[model samples]
Target chain A: MSESPQLTYAEIDRTILDTLRPPTGGYWLAIMALIMGVLLGVACWVYQIFIGIGAGGQNIPVAWGTYLINFVFWVGIAHSGTLISAILHLMRAGWRNPIARAAETMTVFAVSIAGLFPFIHLGRVWLVYYMLPYPNQRYLWPNFQSPLVFDVVAISTYLIVSSLFWYTGLVPDLAAVRDKATGVRKKIFTILSLGWTGKHEQWRHYTRGYLFFAALATPLVISVHSVVSWDFALSVVPGWHSTIFAPYFVAGAIHSGLAMVLTLLIPLRKIFRYERIVTMKILEAVAKTIIFTGLIVGYAYGVEYFLAWYSHSAVEIEAFRWRALGDYSLEFWIMVVCNSLVPLLFFFKRVRTSIPWLLGISILINIGMWYERFVIIVGSVAHGFMPHAWGLYRPSGIEYGIMLGSFSLFFLFFLLFVKHLPSISMTEMKETLDLGESHGD
Target chain B: MATDISVIGLFPDEQKTAAVIEAMSGYPWLIDRVHSPFPSHKIFDALKLKKSPVGWFTLAGGILGFFTGFSLAIYTALEWKLIIWGKPIIAWIPFVIVGFEFTILFSVLGNVLGLLALGGLPDFKGLKQYDPRCSGGHFGIVATCTEEEQDQVIEFFQNQGGEVTIFE
Candidate 1:
């Protein structure tokens, strides 16, 4: 265990608040770029809403297009937060202390972004409430048999519990913020903190409550992606109809989630001067976990192909054959190289430790995961059982623009979060220092 | 009779704070509260408080959520009488998904509710004696005592080399 340097209470408080100070010009420049992208995305959505679903690239066979791909991508990205926060904490991993706050924040924002696509995909957004099982004048209820309905339930539940977990964890740190803040800032933090006074009576219950939330959230992390995968797996579609999808999707989710966390944290640590707290040792541990998950994803890929051949199902074989050699052949090879081959570099100590290497590999994983969804959703639907109905589907400019906007929105939220809240958990970091001192680290 | 006032002792070291709690365990002064930046097992053992009952709330809520989710799905299916994929109205297998989702939803609600109800949270009015430094890195002990014992309380904190603040 590489120890973090001992930090005093005042020093920890000061270091974290310094990140909240007014941004430099570069910060504003980045924010403006993100805002422009977001605004462009909104304009595209408005135009689509007015001109109808034709503005999107959704055709007969490929009704689920880039919006669906972005949905799964964002949902997949949301997994790492809970994995690092709830799962690692339950397993007694001490290194998660300084990073859990940011990871959980990522989960919240990614899910928010993911939740939007379904509404965007709904052509008549006003009738979107038809998806709910409320007692309505029409007396129609959503079919529980549909994985889409399960998705609604699962994603919404994940959002609520994840938000609760994130906010409850923030209470102590928010109290710290309230103490250091002045005037209007203090009032906002105080209300957000709900009068957390660090009294033992509240701490006793608070600790227990946090533990329960973690336990509750752990299964949620697993169930969410499983339900998402079922959205494809439940169908008789050749490429998607497989038993391996749930665990496969879960592993891939963690793989991409870890990559995204590293992608965000590397620059964040450098920019905010948090090298001491977010040490290279912690980064290495994360990289090591990524290598393991990446291998699982690679194994899943090989098994998927092998199973299709072994079963001697003509339809399945044709789907795999087309995926490797047909219309989307370039995307297929790129995903294989990015997801399966690139991560193997981490096996060497040098690549894992180098910030540039880690950043490059992370961005590759993000792109690869998005293509993974694109290939699974579009590639399968593009060439169906009826070859006569099969046709090519390409994303239009509006599709590309909206996708760009989604990314900008995600980063914009992260920028605001980094600027305002304590990105690292102040209370937990102080405890780590105390624990280090007692153990003579 | 509302004759009780309290004095809080703040210390830079956790061991010193834990020691004060141990020393006052048998005293008449109520040592119902101690403040620290993080949870301390030593102070917890010294105070001899019971395990928090918050988990019970989660358990209760999870059970209710499961039933609520199942009932809703089943009721909708039965009432609507709509069948897809030629399946039966009460498809327990598919309903399991809805049930599982609500289980998490209600359990989280229970957890937050238990936190607020049992921990007495959101009390902006009652925090007169809270020292901000306790959140920074200090440990504090708050003891409610009669006015007559106020001097002894202050003396006790002084004897322990603590920074004392008395709240009326």
Candidate 2:
């Protein structure tokens, strides 16, 4: 809603398309670094595979370690993308037009990265196909009642739906690029654009399809995360088995995701010169939403402890108590401070509007979120019922390498996305221009 | 197939283009297609097109997906006859999550299919008559007419301040 007034339709197309210009030497250097990180992760995984799963610190008690934590963290990071692209579109938030594309791209990449952690966690990654429901000579069928099976269905559906929704939005913009490009680029865009010509007939069905995808995606986003939460909620672990896990996880996911969007977008806005399009108004709006979600997350934390006390169950009480006061208490406190307390700073307009403060808080919140999952997964599993079986879990070097690799892969995909495609929606920007012009008259 | 001989009018402003489209309502069939860089309800209203039936595809896909999800769960459970937690062999409650995900996934696929099919997309021939400016800031109206009416259509577009081109 706060786009620059002087922007013409031509300027919008040109400026957005300009972002796709050839990457400079610095860009390649960053890409090279990310590629190295990715290879290090791969090398670690290969070593783990050859040396056995025990090489990465998964003992009897703390079987689910940093891999699960990273899985939940990355998935949580993906939530805000759908919330922005689909939910905001449904709400008709005009401010979403410029930021939607970036958010959606993040969703695609984050989800892709998130999907990999399960396989990385699966020491025998080659056996992943067995998780799929298929007929075989063994006549073994995946249990439909299992939450793990639900994760497979939910995550696969999410990845597919998010990709479709993202591509559907990109079609017209690809056409705009196609028209501007020539030779190889033109041919590539022509195919990617699916021969879009922006005809009224195409727009008619395209709008309807886009709306339907958004509608479908809105519920899918909620359901996917809910399913992910059930992976723990359905368990008998004292800290994990709670009805509040779904909404609590969903809120925490959005909170972290909003932080990540800020984390990525702030630097992107500066580097890409998208300050006019992704303005202070938009950033402030995101920060405000972060406050609301952060509060919900904070409340969930309190309620979790309250429930532990209210249930009068000794194990549940001990689980909550040990989480805050035990070996991993540092992580627990960091999660609390970052995920809940940090966003409270945004209540003041000054903190909310300050670029440095916003960026710093966003990054801190992401770290807090990662720790939140770590505390829940490892802490709960480590300090479960029966003291003799209890043990603390530390992420071995391989685990850290894989986690770093996932982040590198995520960023590498995003960097490639920025260089190849129009990072902003040129079509929507032009529509805003037309609407603004009409309102002006 | 031979392309239709049409008179194309390119307008710089969307408002003027919508006005020209509205003025051409009397000769509705003469308007082959109106193009713009973005979707304009104004142009859509001027064209007076019927509502898209893409929702039907989505609805059908949802129903199909729901059944497919339930059937897979039920049939596989029945086939295995293995009850771990003493729950029912056909537990409808847990299957709802699977059905819900599939419903959304298939519905999205259907919507995309309907869009491509109904919109006549992947239309390689579309570029033949398309002006690149339409993808930038221009609005284009392609109207087809007989040889006699071509001159009149060109004159009409010119009068409406549109830059006209004839595709023969």
lDDT of 1: 0.90
lDDT of 1 by residue, A130-151 (tens): 9988888888988887899999
What is candidate 2's local distance difference test score? 0.89
Interface RMSD of each: 1.0, 0.7
- Top candidate when judged by DockQ against the true structure: 2
Candidate 1 TM-score, true structure as reference: 0.97
Off by over 4 Å in 2: A1-4, A436-441, B1-3, B27-29
lDDT of each: 0.90, 0.89
Candidate 1 segments exceeding 4 Å error: A1-4, A437-441, B1-3, B84-86
Each candidate's DockQ: 0.81, 0.85
- Report the lDDT tens digits of candidate 2 across residue range A311-425: 9999999999999998989999999999899999999999998999999999999999999999999999898999998998898998999989999999999999999999989
